[model samples]
Target: MSQALAHNIIAEADYLATEERASVRHELVGGEMHAMAGASERHNRIAGNIFFHLRAATRSKTCRAFMADMKLRLGQGALFYYPDAMLVCDPTDDHPHYKQAPCFIAEVLSPATAKIDVREKWSSYQTLPGLRYYLLVDAERLWAKCYSTNATGQWFEQELSAEDRLEIDCGDAHITLTLNDIYEDTGLLL
Candidate 1:
């Protein structure tokens, strides 16, 4: 959708509400609140695969893995967003309201939302304090790009392909997996 159209459809006067009745997550951009869309088959598969692996690896620890259903309150303007998969090592995130601390966040791109995922959402997620790595899993390509926060407060990116393995450090937890493990059974785009 065009920026002009988005601005027109979402008016500037709709930001007065403090809360909503239902559980629908609304993303606010440029004073417009855009309702999040549902996930596709490929999105579900990628999320499930990632979550399964992470859960198994971190099963014995206090760290936990959450799927798309859980809500992540990234910021105040952005009330909620459902990530494809997330890993939180902080024990405080176990609260009922929403996960406040996320060590790792992943979003599986789709045709309709690829631009938002890669651009707008990426920028917003990078600003989170508890976030260490933000991963964008490509829908068309058999690759993923991870943005890690360096000590200098700058983001360092690493691209992982079919030939590479992913090793992520989440504070108290460490998890490693190969591309083959994530794309098992399901045919990957590579």
Candidate 2:
């Protein structure tokens, strides 16, 4: 079972309203709101590495990369989540509070959210038509899991070791994230 913060049931509207004023972030699951915990230094470093490389890669393009602040509306608003990192190439996905379409999503695995990120989110994110790559980044290791969608819209899992490179091809937008880039600044990268 996945652990949730606060462990309370809240309506979607109520959660949204409170989340704006709340200091910390929260994710809505099945109409229930769970407060998001602060990440470790290593986790933030890993996420920041990916975000920095992605931001630079898409700087001149129409796409934008966000680091854990943008909300993703999943299951047609049935679930609201904050992915660790995301890239949206479509202008329509530029919503104020939440985003509907994302070309790529990254989740840095932690003990508390790994199961939910890998299992629940895995199933939920596939529903988006624009999503092409979903990356599961390991904080304690150098490996990552890349799940890519095919032309038929079927998702396949690919393992990325330290020797592998990440090639993200979105609609007219592309970015290549290497393991060293994703783990930059960490001793592992050197």
The best candidate by TM-score is: 2
TM-score of structure candidate 2 = 0.91
lDDT of each: 0.73, 0.87
Model 2 lDDT, residue 83, Cα:
93
lDDT per residue as tens, model 1, 1-190 = 6554334443322432422443665555655566777777767788788888778877888888998767676566344567888898998777564576888888888898889889887887877887888888866557778888866778889888777777888866787766666655557745
The residue pairs in collision within model 1 are none
Give each model a TM-score: 0.79, 0.91
Model 2: per-residue Cα lDDT over 1-190, one tens digit each: 9986775667777878998899999888887778899998889999998888778888788888888988998876779999999998898776799988899999999888899999999889988988999999888777789999889988889898767778998766678887888888877674
User: Which segments of candidate 2 are over 4 A away from where they belong?
Assistant: 1-9
